[model samples]
Target chain A: MIRRPANLRRFGLGLLVAMPAALVVWWFLAAPLLVPGMAPAFAWLLQLIWPQWGPAVEVNGNAWLVVTTLPLLEQPLQSAAIPLGPRRFTAAFALFWGLVLATPGDLPLRRRLRQLLAGSVLGILPLVLLMALLAFHFQLAVVINHQPALTVTPPSVHVLALPYPGWQFHLIGVGRQLGVLVLPTLGPVLMWAVLNRRFIRAMIFTGLLSRLPAAAGELDHRDGRA
Target chain B: MSRGLLIGLTVVVLAGCDAAPQDLRRALAMLHNDQGAAAFTQLQDLAATGYAPAQFRLGMLYLQGEVNAERRTLAERWLMRAAAQGDVGARYYRALLWLSRRRDADAVDAGAQALERLAADGFRPATLRLAQAYEAGDGVQPDVAQALSWYEQAAAQGERRAIERLATAYQNGELGLERDAALAQRWRRQLAREPFSLSD
Candidate 1:
């Protein structure tokens, strides 16, 4: 109403809300993936079994793979698209937030697309690291529980190697502890951002339509004056 | 004809309908009285017209190998025919045949199609077998949805094993379920009851 532009404020507010929420939900859902009694997780995982998620690493009674986490995003999206109850509400909330936060106002269409992509990448980058750490912990737990007899191999070597130490991680460099945003994977996030933007635009459509009455009233008044 | 002869004949014929009702009651009594051999003979004569219960019972006898050398495939074929004609118990036995061969998906399909007859009143032994099918992945894809469906069915029918399975599914949320602690507790509480449904 006063000074600042409505578009910029709304976009900032939207990003400030949605991106963190997506990460929060990712971490929340990752609890079952990280925890034990994971039959349901594996059962659901079976549905996600693609050769592309990465090669499977069978350890102990469990298995883990280093797939791009974008597949995870798709599962939740497909889940949310036709879900019932509170989960549906959560998806709507996330989509709405993504639109408001990621989009840039007071810019041309091309620049706006650029800003939105950049913002979403900055937001999603941390979560990818979190997911890799989670995978390492889960796989390590599996291997430790199924240690072999100490006859042929030394006990110290195998037990400790099941979980590589921090210095070892620094030296050998496995897992996503370092926040290297996979530039290629951003394509999926951008696709989802586009989808989320469309969803928010859908919700805001009714407000846009509310102006139709005012436009009609002004058109009638102008015709009378003419 | 003489009047005395006519009156006597009329009285005798008039008493037959009353005896028909009494005879059915007696048949149920004889079946319950451990006079299976005699009751079977009577039921067999009555059942020859292809009544479903007679066909089901005779099918059961053949299925169990007690009355003679068990002819399971033949028994299943007859029971399948009886079940198709709406014999409620026949679905239960026929499900067993499909299950024994690890055809759980087919068994479950059979159980659900016949639910209005078999599981309509309550879960029974046959219904519990359907639940086991979902759990063990015998003939169907291992699914929490189907497992939960069968567990709830058998639990309603008073199958203890089904009650246990439902408890596990609820407690673990193993079947794409949201964690509902209250429903899990309720199922646990219901566990300590007498066998109330047809499962007994």
Candidate 2:
């Protein structure tokens, strides 16, 4: 039991030490490899919406995915931004590294590997959902915001119909914000907590009750003269 | 092993290898593995040899900001070479680079010509660029008629921006087109029919 806690602490320390290196690898190396896979997944998600129609994703060697739609009219307008970029994937990769490093060390290497893999899979599910939401937001943003570079005569017509509903944009904005700011950090922490619940419980018990002399004295009050 | 000896021996062996294709593959592998600087070194000789793909790849690496200022100039040179060889990607990016850089009118004209060729090949983005060029006279003479025609072509190809522009122009009598609310409404109806899809 003592060794287990020490091992857990050691694992936590290992994560602290390894995090910067992990982030570097995630940004420089892992993101590029993941882009090819991520592009297709983003396309597949888009395909789910348009049925047979979907944007095509091209992977640049620098690890960016350029999403192109088939001619919306006479020509294809490339989407304003990459559907998923290094910034998006790097966060999740950092989370994976955290999970791998901080997972309970008493578990066998294979078991730990399985846990890491499972945690990564779970983390990616929500990320993919976020990507789809961002893609929709981006497509709308490009369509509405992009104007041809030439001056056309002023139109008297009022644009009564917004292409996308108002609520959807709000929702996408919130989801994207969360994806960038919260999910990357929180997702892995939650996974780590869940996977190592027993260790956590033990740590809690050891930290609060068993390790406290004051609590032990309180327990012995019945036999005291006072 | 002495460092100089090791370097000399490796250079001699690499010189004898003479397999540009394999070197290119190795460069690609290095890039995929996130060794962009190394990939650039590998690509240099092949690009100098006038290989179209290597030139294109070098241009991309330069665009990626993987290389310094000197290399950035090399990127334009390589991209121009690739474009001359009729590489579609090279043509597209070189056009974009010229536009983004907002180079002189002559450069803009060159970019427009590249775009026009691609547009002739039925590429929608090129068609859109050609329309913009005609409308703004950015590189070509401003011709509302040419612009509208290009817009119509793009809209026929299902370009969303073109559709929106055409609808607005028809409604407002912009771009020298006569105001026709009926035609505008028809395009609006088409826009409505092509709904944006997202899963909840």
Candidate 3:
């Protein structure tokens, strides 16, 4: 029972207005608070994965500082710190919200809000977590490879050994590159498509509506005009 | 009209994100999406027509995923062509490919020589790589003095790897250098000032 052409215009205008507003709100309000708040979770995860490193995470503004022990060759444990900006992975949250808010106004407000909550928890959160882990591993590998005194063993069958194998570094490299380049832009679009499949189909396939039982004769008059 | 507008907007966004030519950008997008065969088909004509970026990208594709001797040779040829056109990335990767042939002493020497030239041009990665080669005696002789000098040069240019190496070397008195806590502390401070980024 949705109107064609007019609703599409509304959707476009809504997107144009909402996208930048969402991005601004995210950058100033949400990201600054959320990224810093993520430090504890990341610290716990890193500690679980790499207990030998004795990972300690601290927040400095929006960035997380990870202090860890470096096991150099024939030397006592040396301290090193790596800084990570979670904002890079969290921008998709804004994009997803923008798309959700821009859905056709005819839809129930409560349903839209529900979709927003689901998208945030189900899609964006997992993406941010995965990207952070990949980025952290890649950064640590680079640091380990740079240290001349650290003896890295050759490629081993065990992938997660303390002294990382060469192939693991390569795998981390590819994962990091994909996380940095592709996921930020594509993740939101896919989420929006999944949530708005009905709306999308109605907009794209007006001719096919005549064959459906629900709105068969209802859309027939407009099909020729469309 | 709305559909047309959406398509237009998508094209504008994609084009605005990258400064590369439209076709080359499409090829790169294909490659990113793991459409290797399609990307190869699109890039071949551009690379044949002497587009340096296309040559470089095509060469990189050839090196990807279970590369054999034939693919390596093709990669080298395309990389050399791109390097001749002054693609810095191609030149660096070509040197790396040469260095990977460790059993071939001549190739190793050639790679080391390429790295030295790139370092002289103030490419930070090249400076760091040359220092590592000197330290590990990968292709060059194990000269502690040369390694320290190259590491210093790279560190001065704000290369994080070189800074880390220098900090460790000075702290441990490794690489035949006298232990200097002050220098190590200075390098560590510099390292802390360097921002972390995923890009090389």
Candidate 4:
């Protein structure tokens, strides 16, 4: 079935390449929406504008996740921070999709198709990370605003409870909050292992593709040579 | 090599690739793991070389009554050193220590003068203390005008206590207030509605 992991590897390379671009998009897109005279506080501006992201986070060797308000009530949620926001997604999508559609015109069919999908998926990273960061900022906003009692309630919400051990919720809230804030720039890191696997596979694919004939060179060339 | 050994070695290599990050992480871990004493020792080593955070930390540790030995003088010294480095935390403590010392009203004009300097430097605690001195005629003659001004400056810095004082002062026409009901009502509303803002 084209090997699911092989499919994922290509996805990660595309994402890594797109991360910086996404950062630029996030800054440019969200900067205008910020309150006047608030120059250059990327995290604060992002959090203020799209507070749904919660707050930025840092964890596990600078790894991160930028959570947005898709509101899954998820457990063991990812968290991170970086320069990220909503606008980057639109810009990355357009860039990746544009490259993908542009390739089919001149490149070989299989190569062109795969490149398109890889580009599209990879392009989504910047936007995905941005959305995640914005969401995290908002989550932090809520926490700062609510100062929610750090009590584990039915596993739905993890509060950072004090003086009481055995509570996963508090750790989750603190970790995830940190994870999401740092996730935008760092979220792509999650894709590294996946990307490494893909790169090896892609190299294998390249080896095989180059070794194999290009559709057997239409076969008629052999007859003509004879 | 056997596959398992190879895999283990590869994992070890990947894990050890970031030694610096690991060390920094370990240091941060000490900070969070309630090894404050150990952290303080390392921080003090850094502080001896004039690290701003370390100085600020030492100052705060002294001013704040932790289980550690009470070293008020050392606290002020470290706090001053860090404050001179423009560390906000150190500056905060500098204001605190300066304000903490109580003096008989007219006997120590120099202490009050020093407080005025801290107050002008955007230290909310100092501003409030100076205001109190004016309000109570503690160090100088009770000058309602100076008290009101100092209170306003402190209020602007989000000191809730000062905001409350200013609100009350304006409301009661105390501290040389001319009984301007309009201004008093405005300040009070600003406090109630915008707990942080300086104006209505």
Candidate 5:
């Protein structure tokens, strides 16, 4: 009954074929460079924030950096173990979004590849920005939460209510709760929606969108934008 | 004669097991009772057999320099033997011994290397010592960043000296660090939370 079941089926097949290959490329090539590359950038940002708060920074393997931050008494301690959680953009998500943006209709293989490559860059740029912001927020949160525990002598105050700036707390709250948890999967879907708004509208109304109440007509406007 | 022979055989069997345990127990008991010479005698027998605890105790007695004139030499011998057997106290004391020689470069290096290994394993005192060495350039190159790193590590392990040092460093911009009063106050606030003990 669907007008473009073949296209959907073809996209699924293409996804199955391309996913593993993409993962292999990301793991072997992209990850090694990308993960460690975050360290100096993170350190620089921290230094800019607090000129005197430089700690020993080093990359641990290729997946993350274990940063020893702050001195207690006069010794070093691990303040944060920052990991580059690449699951969001590395394998399944990348392939699924690529297929959605590339071969949404009955496009030829060359055209599909061109669309896929272009859409991937556009989709990944937002993700990369989100990751960098999250890293900064995450480190700030860690220090705020753990600062009191790194004590030498008896503390006069029992607890510190707000360790970081007021804005930092809000930033961390949003970054951790929304950006880190929700955005990875949602980002690709949203990106795909932007790329192929028409196809999404046609598919949705024909399938589940038709079953929804009259209030769902708002989505029709979105579909028309494509 | 046969009954007497049997009694003698039983006594011999009882004595066959190492008497080091009993000697150690007696030594501790004698020391507890304030009988220092008796304890020393008991410790000597067990220490001669290369018992680590006895050796460490004997080394401490000599290191105290209260019992004899050749205390340093005797302390070195016993502490070295105990250290070879991986006694923590012995290792710490031996490192301290080397560190105390302010003018001896070789001694400082030896102490620094030993403490560095311990520091890497998250030993608080060793971490603090290593940080100081880096800060002062006693046995190693003067690297304020490295000192800060070590101080941070020690602070993480709840070392009071390291924590205070960090707060001071941030406050005064010592150790090649920039002055940050906010961080200094933050650490100062932490110092108020619980009682810090040197023994910790």
Candidate 6:
């Protein structure tokens, strides 16, 4: 087993060194390239779901410009572009990478790399899904707000037969607040904690680790003979 | 001691989960899910029971989706009820609804008064709206000075739209203000640092 004091020091030092570097790489290179590419996928998904909406995606630097038809109150359907900075969500990847890298060097390089890959998938996929859902919810709000106008003629193209119920809007609103405020910050930490639970216990909860017989046995087994 | 602490924490967490907001959210979710009848059934009861948020939401729903005269009246009634209970959102929406009815001079006057009160109370959206009203002569008389003052108030509150407006006004010497490129640049820089929100 890795010495507790040395492991803690190494992890702390690793975090101090890796965090800024990871953030710099993510912000300057990876996010700019990867974030813009997500727009097309989002556009494809939106179009697939709401064919009549005819969602279009445009890349403007790090932001995705999503242009889609939105029903307006007392007016014909108008095309609106909602610019989403998905880079904000992808920034969590930097934190995830930093945490993964900051893990003590005792873990096998192959396993650490696997953990990093898993963290990336776990961290990013939900954010992507959230962005998509927020976009859809925003568009749905437009439809809901203009339900009366949409029911009338001249705007014969009905995006949805009936607008989503009010409770769904509240749910989306809550989801959005959580996604924006909580998830981006907490998600990476949670992922890191789960992935490095053993390391965490060894470093921070040594007493608890020793007190739990099963945990102690598992650690001993991992250290040598089962 | 640890076990007691854990129990205390659990109790606190449980206590923090207010059922009212959850119920309100569920009703709103029903409304968004196209289950208007069900949402209304829940909301109307809550609103009738003098739940300010429910009343405000019901008002907003009617304002947004209902075009009929009777529904409009109902929207006004619900909004008024909520506003009477000191719901700022309800008050703002009610004022906006009244302002939109420009044909009724009395309603426009009431809206202008309500907006002025809200602006004075340091409500950012209300300040911005009041400024716009003065600038465009929507519900109130076109007063460049009043517009500038309200815009400045909103800008002080870090309202992006107000900042942009002031920046443009200063740059072009609009609203009878002296053109100052330096002031315009400062506002522009502030705007750059201001975080963009979807709502904004």
Ranking by lDDT: 3, 6, 2, 5, 4, 1
Please identify model 3 stretches exceeding 4 Å from their true place.
A1-5, A72-77, A147-163, A207-226, B1-200
lDDT, candidate 5, A42-146, per-residue tens: 444444453322322356674444232222322111122234453343443454444464444766777656656666665655465455556545544444333
Model 1, which residues run further than 4 Å from truth?
A1-226, B1-43, B66-70, B99-112, B115-128, B153-164, B171-183, B192-200
* DockQ per model, Cα: 0.01, 0.02, 0.02, 0.01, 0.03, 0.02
**What overall lDDT goes with each candidate model?**
0.46, 0.62, 0.73, 0.49, 0.60, 0.70
lDDT of 6 at A112: 87
- State the lDDT of candidate 1 residue by residue for A35-144, as single tens digits: 23332333233223421112222223223332221111111100000000112112322443355445654456666566545543454323432343333333332222
Q: How far off is each candidate at the interface, as Cα RMSD in Å?
A: 31.7, 17.1, 18.7, 16.6, 21.5, 17.0
Error of 1 at B8 (Å): 21
- Write one digit per residue (lDDT tens) for candidate 6, span A25-62: 99898887777767656665565565433456678887
Stretches of candidate 6 off by over 4 Å are A1-226, B1-17, B197-200
Q: How close is chain A of candidate 1 to the true chain A, as a TM-score? A: 0.27
Q: What are the per-residue Cα lDDT tens digits for candidate 5 across B11-73?
A: 655433334543555576577588989889888888888887677778877865374547877
* DockQ of candidate 6 compared with the true complex: 0.02
Query: lDDT tens digits, residues A34-63, model 3?
Result: 787777767766766765455667798878
lDDT of 1 by residue, B1-200 (tens): 59999998776555322322223334444765878778667655645666555556556656543533357766776678767875545665665566555545666565445543444444354466556666777665577677678778777644556676666667787666667677777777776543222210
How would you class the docking of model 3? Answer: incorrect
> Considering only chain A, what is the TM-score of each predicted structure?
0.27, 0.68, 0.76, 0.28, 0.57, 0.71
Q: Which ten residues in a row have the lowest lDDT in candidate 1 chain A?
A: A76-85
For model 4, the superposed segments whose C-alpha errors exceed 4 Å read A1-226, B1-36, B66-70, B102-126, B136-142, B156-161, B192-200
In model 1 chain B, the worst 10-residue window by lDDT is B16-25
Q: What tens digits encode model 4's per-residue C-alpha lDDT throughout A95-163?
A: 443323322123467775665456445644444544544444344433322222323112123221111
Ten residues in sequence with the least summed lDDT for candidate 2 chain A:
A152-161
Stronger candidate by TM-score (1 vs 2): 2
The segments of candidate 5 whose C-alpha lies over 4 angstroms from its true place after superposition are: A1-226, B1-26, B66-69, B136-143, B193-200
Per-residue lDDT of B62 in model 4: 58
